[model samples]
Target: MRVLLVKLSSLGDVIHTLPALTDAWHAVPDIHFDWVVEEGFAEIPGWHPAVAHAIPAALRRWRRDWRSTRAERHAFRARLRAQRYDRVIDAQGLIKSALVARQAIGPRWGLDRASAREPLAAWTYRHRVRVPREQHAVSRTRALFAAALDYSIPNTVADYGLARERLPVPSTAPGDLLFLHGTTWPSKHWPEAYWCELMALAAADGLRVLLPWGDETEHARAERIAVAGAGHGFVLPRSGLGELAALIASARIVIGVDTGLAHLAAALGTPSVTLYGATRPDRTGTFGEAQIHLSARFPCSPCLTRECGYRGASVVRPACYEALDPARVWAQTRETMSGSREMAHGA
Candidate 1:
């Protein structure tokens, strides 16, 4: 069977969709699985051995320019239509994704709008599988396919096989923990002062700390953490996604906020403790991978709002993360790392 799985954009969402393939492939071992994904995230699907092809949907770059966009998109559409896939699964339930799946020369399938992350995206599917809304996003993807194909969903299987390059871990004993302190969205970030305290505590325990910064603001934030920790912190050179993955793979442990890199760390099977604020771990947390700590103390938690509102509030102000104490996070970090070591030793 030539199966086409459509999931594009947002690193976390793509990571969540990975496990579905394990069961899908098992259900159809002779299947040739090809994923339609954003160019930026295409590397992820390429890491999976079950995937026969990683079809790049350059939607991210498409909106930026017209000439190249039209040329590339036309070519991509032609190639996709030529495949005549046996089954096409729209894992990403968006209007654009549905349209893309329909463009494929195959019988189209997707989640019903009520079950879709984006409900409106469902109308475009030729067939919609109604799944439980409460299911975790990863499970939702797996269940959607299972429901459509009449195959049982398999137990969780986390496998991402990245090709090894010349990138190698340094020979020096790892004394420092990697702290990913920046996020694309401001609402998801933990308080800067809290990071300062965490870095200080980690360094005090004789662990060197390095913070990787992407932009100037993140660089400034790293500088602030370094100054607060009295030079125990330093920023790493700007890195591409693959390099960042390699770096996270080498770290003894990763301490981070709830963001893409943090999710990447968990998906890579590295020891990590991610801080959650407005988001619920159940919905999109590290799956079958690493330890996760969530702050559910706030009454308004799992608000699902990019911004929190206190009774009569409608803006994106998040107070849930602010209530998380540094000491509590530190304790969780230690426990997670200890558990990771035990798991490693088969104890």
Candidate 2:
């Protein structure tokens, strides 16, 4: 059976949808998938064995200046509509995602009105499946795919079907530990001081720390962190998603804030310690083996807002992150690494 899976932008959201393909791959016989994802995250779907094609969706880019990109938008629509599939599943329950799913040639399926984040998105789906929203995002997606594709949801832990050999290993020696500190939201960012402390802590423990940066701000932060970490810490050159994925795959342990790379580490089955301040870990934390999450003990935590309500309320910008300090994160990181090493040695 051929299926077109529509799950668009936001790096974290795209990562969250991987395990569902794993589930579908295992349960369905000869099931082929074509995934529609944001152009930036186009590399992800191809990592899965079940995905025959990773259809690039430039919705985010085209929408920036819709009037100027009419021809490109038209071409994208034409390409999407050209392929007739057995099923087009809209894994993302947003209106924009619904629109994308509607453009595909197939019997559409998605979360029903009550289960969808944007209830109106359900209108586009011919077969509306009701998956509970209370569960973690990974579990919810697994259930959604099961319902959409006529298979029972597996009881076992989620498996993101990414292979080690598929990734191109970087030529540089792998760092003993990788620190993924860059995040999209201000409230989600762990303080630079805290990150610097963790880098120094890792260095003191005879661990080489690799810090990756995407933009100028993150580069600056990494530079400061590398200096604080002394000789053992190094800042990596600006890397693409694939390069960063390779780095994540190569690291002995990954220590990160609540970022998409943290999710990538989880998906890659890398032992990781993820610190959560403003966000709740239970609902959408990193899922998979050898993953640990530390959420802040603040009243306004998990506010689910881009901006912090308690800014300037305490020493930390978000104030909630005060509880999730460097010492706390470092301790957890050490414990997780120790556990991973012991497990590796069959202890």
TM-score of each: 0.89, 0.97
Among all candidates shown, the one with the greatest TM-score = 2
* Full-model lDDT for every candidate: 0.77, 0.88
For candidate 1, give the lDDT: 0.77
Candidate 1 local lDDT, 1-347, one digit each (tens):
88898999788888787777767766875876899998888778766667888899987678888676787889999979886888899998888898888889888899897888789888887899988877778788888878766688776565543444534444333434788888876667788888889988887876778788889999889888987667677677766776777778777788888778877777677888887877878878766667576554677776766655665433223567656767988898888878877888996
Give the least accurate 10-residue stretch of model 2, judged by summed lDDT. 164-173
For candidate 1, the TM-score is 0.89
Write candidate 2's Cα lDDT for 1-347 as tens digits: 99999998778888899899989999999999998899999998878899998888888778788999999889889888887999999998999999999999999999999999899999999999888778898998998999888999998888998977788777556898998888988889888888888888888988898999999999998999999878988889878888889888989999888999999999999999988877778888999899998899988888888878884569877778888888988888888888888888995
Superposed Cα deviation of residue 169, candidate 2 (Å)? 2.4
Q: Among these predicted structures, which one has the highest lDDT? A: 2
Cα error, residue 72 of model 2, in Å, equals 1.8
